[model samples]
Target: MNFGERLRFLRNELDYSLRKMADELDISFSALGKYERNEHQPDFETLKKIADYFDVSIDWLLGRTQEGYDHAIRIIDNAVEKMDPNSEVELYIPPAILNEMILKNIDESHLSLIPVYGAANGMLNLSESNIIQYEFKHNQDMPEESFFYIISPDDSMKGSNIVKDSKVLCRSLDIVDKKNLEEGKIYLVSYQNSLYIRRVFVNNQDQITLQAENVHFPPILIHNMSDINIIGQVQSVEFNPNEQK
Candidate 1:
């Protein structure tokens, strides 16, 4: 199920009558039905209200994860609350593609194509059991291990001019590269169980700090590097808010 399907599923499973829900949300019944039908996406405020009403994370509502309340509550209830969007941009990567690349560590002949993902979940490992589709967009010479893309989830990185729906380019890092992280550079990181796209700073004492380009989001400090995984350094981005895909 995609976002709309999941929304409907939740309403049915939880016995949230459409009329009741619509009234509670202060929206028309037809609008609520449209949301369930995937005909319209709720604005941020309405989206937040829906999440709060359903007690689910935005990621789960968007079908980013199969995890239930126990696991997803972390993203919403923890510190930096409402800060990270768990930007899971669903892609059409079929299982066959994962097997081809992961099992064989496919050679450079296949390097021209890399997967771009949403900044939703942690990127400790790339193979997601539920991901579908096998679409590939040619990217010349991008053979770096763990090279990937993320559709910008929000305007937190707007200070860097990276806005929502921006296609961000990035590549994972090795231990050496992680240790020698350049100060004042942006990185895609996994903190707790969620993914974050932020500017990174490493202190002489090995502490790490995650800063958002948009000042609205205060910089996050990590006393223990173990708490977060440095997914990769963001290389470039392309933006088009009206993007169909």
Candidate 2:
């Protein structure tokens, strides 16, 4: 069966009515029917919501693969929002899309869409997963990797330019190694399963103390050396509270 057919089958197997699924998905009931009948296709954003709701990968929804959903929590949870006023944004992706992209690296040149949350909309505190695709002309010094955006959750390290709602470019690094945790540099440290963007204050001691930029947040003291894992270091940050207004 095609992706659309499979989507319909799953919806039915779960004993969800068309309107119920539509309401949950923030889509019109007729639209859900259309997707089932293969009359139309969901955009990337909508597809992501559907995938998240079903706990399936986009690849699976697209009929790219025939594997049962395996729910594995990743490091960071990417979120998305729906445009509809009546529904909330859900996280869902098909396994097929992920698998295919893994096998054959996604061609970034074909897609250049960026997901921008309407920060102005107070009624809508929404997050959307936007995969932006772009191609640049040949240049002498091309960056090894483009900056991926991540929003900060704390104000500690404001002294070092980190604040809440700060969009940052984090250079991926191996933070687990003691040698990798350089002194005086800001790093996104994952201590005891929770992720924190802070400066490594005292890596010299057997216990590491992570200091926050803002005075309000308390310093994180990690006792077990084995529990600390560094995900990446903050290269730069951009703060714009005005957008939320």
How do the predictions measure up, each by TM-score? 0.46, 0.41
Q: Where is the poorest 10-residue window by lDDT in model 1?
A: 75-84
Prediction 1 global C-alpha lDDT:
0.64
* lDDT, candidate 2, 73-170, per-residue tens: 22002212223334443333334443333333333342222222222221112234332211121222324253234565555666766555666656
- Residues 1-245, model 1: lDDT tens digits: 78888778667755779997788778889999999999998888888888887676787777776565333233224322322345343334344443333222333244333455544442322444322211333344666346765777787888776787677777777533456777889887888776678998887877788989887879888888777877788887756564547
lDDT of each structure?
A: 0.64, 0.58
**Candidate 2 TM-score versus the reference:** 0.41
Scored against the true structure, residue 70 in model 1 reaches a CA lDDT of 34
